[model samples]
Target: MTQRLLSFGLGYSARALARRLLAQGWTIHGTTRDAEKAEALAREGVQPLLWGQDDIEPILAQSTHILISAGPDEAGDPVLNAHGALIREHAVRLRWAGYLSTTGVYGDHAGGWVDEETPLAPSTRRGQLRQEAEAAWQAVPGLPLHIFRLAGIYGPGRGPFAKVRRGTARRIIKPGQVFSRIHVEDIAQVLAASIAQPDPGAVYNLCDDDPAPPEEVIAYAAELLGLPVPPAVDFDAAEMTPMARSFYAESKRVRNDRIKRDLGVALVYPDYRAGLDALAQDEAGE
Candidate 1:
């Protein structure tokens, strides 16, 4: 049987996974809200359907696997709000379903380590919504659901190098603040592994081995670019958008043992250094 994936949101992480699945001959149908992005997805060989405007039921009916990357808002999960009933109706036919969640569901851990078993105690509204969304997805009966709680995701186009090179990078110093992160490629591998080995109702944390302070990552990115490390500003003194400031409200090191042990996956970039090194090389080549 040919594997068919219906991706609810073909964003960065889903697009990365789509690249791998498409190369393996999987029929991919993805949804986007923008006309430009739909065209881009089409160029990449994805059957793009505009959310809310296009008919997705037929595509949903035929999909063997589904990936939900659209996040929840104050109103709640957009996909579920729009198609929860339809997905549940087609649940029996789904071989595997994945939900891209965030480690934010674990909330503030005070720079401590947190595994999948950690209780959900989200400290922010964003985290709370994600936690609720996870529960909502779990409520879908008969869906072979798997949740991947991702940490800060970074890769080629989404790295600190750009800021560091532009001289706009600032090391926001929050005494003990540290965060876990995962490479986009690693995220794709983990998703692929879960597809290969279907484990219903499984939850995994996706992150690199190292969880370092925000300043360290900026400093390293500067070092890689042969530029001076940006000056450090105390968290309280830093000028930042509310969204950027919200990220510092929590500090936790997410564990990725389940993805490695259960999926038999190995991260290509286990730390910021390795991920940054590859990104710098790719930038140089381009």
Candidate 2:
């Protein structure tokens, strides 16, 4: 039987996974709010449907696996808010469901380590929203839910190279601050592993082994590009957007043993060094 996946939000990470599945002969149907992107996805071999413009029930019924990457607003999860009842009613062929969440739900751990078993104490509103979204999805009766609390996602076009190239890179130094990040490829791999294993109600932390300071990552990108490393700016003194400032409020090293222990996923890029090296190589090639 051909595997069919319905990606509720065909954004960056979802597109990465969709490309992999498409290569392996799986049929992919993705929903996007943008018309041009829908056309672009269609050209790239994914069947695209517009949000609110197209009926999601037929797609939900046909999907063997469902992945929700759409974020929640103040109103709540757009996918759940719009199609919770329809999903419970029409997901007849669905064997697996995955929710792409964030490790921010763990909030600030004072630069301490947190595993999957750690209780959530979100420090930010965004984190609190994710916590709420996780519960909302888990509450859906008959829905096979797997929540992946992803770390700082960095890969390909979304890496530090762009900021460095634009001369907008800043090394914000915060004492004892460390962050866990994962390559987009690893995120896809972990999701695929979970889909293959099919464990409902499982929660996995998707992150790399090494958790380092944000300044170090920026410096490494500069070294790879042979550019002058951006000067360090103290976090307290740095002029930043409210969103960027909010990100700096949390400091925690996330653990990724569950994905390995449960799904047997071997991460492709285990550290920022390996991930950055690959990105640098790709940049050189381009």
lDDT scores of the candidates, listed in order:
0.95, 0.93
Q: Count the backbone clashes (under 3 Å) in each candidate.
A: 0, 0
lDDT of 2 by residue, 1-286 (tens): 9899999999989998998899999999999999999999999999999999999887777789999999998999999889888887865457999999999999899899999999999999999999999999988887888999999999988989889888999999999999999999999998988888898989999999999999999999999999999999999999999999999999999989999999998989999999999999987898
When summed lDDT is taken over every stretch of 10 residues in candidate 2, the lowest stretch is 85-94
Alpha-carbon RMSD, each predicted model: 0.6, 0.9
lDDT of each residue in 21-98, candidate 1, tens digit only: 999999999999999999999999999999889999999988999999999999999999999889989998999999
- Tell me the TM-score of each prediction against the true structure: 0.99, 0.98
RMSD of 2: 0.9
Off by over 4 Å in 2: 91-93
Instruction: Give the TM-score (vs. native) of candidate 2.
Output: 0.98
The residue pairs in collision within model 1 are none
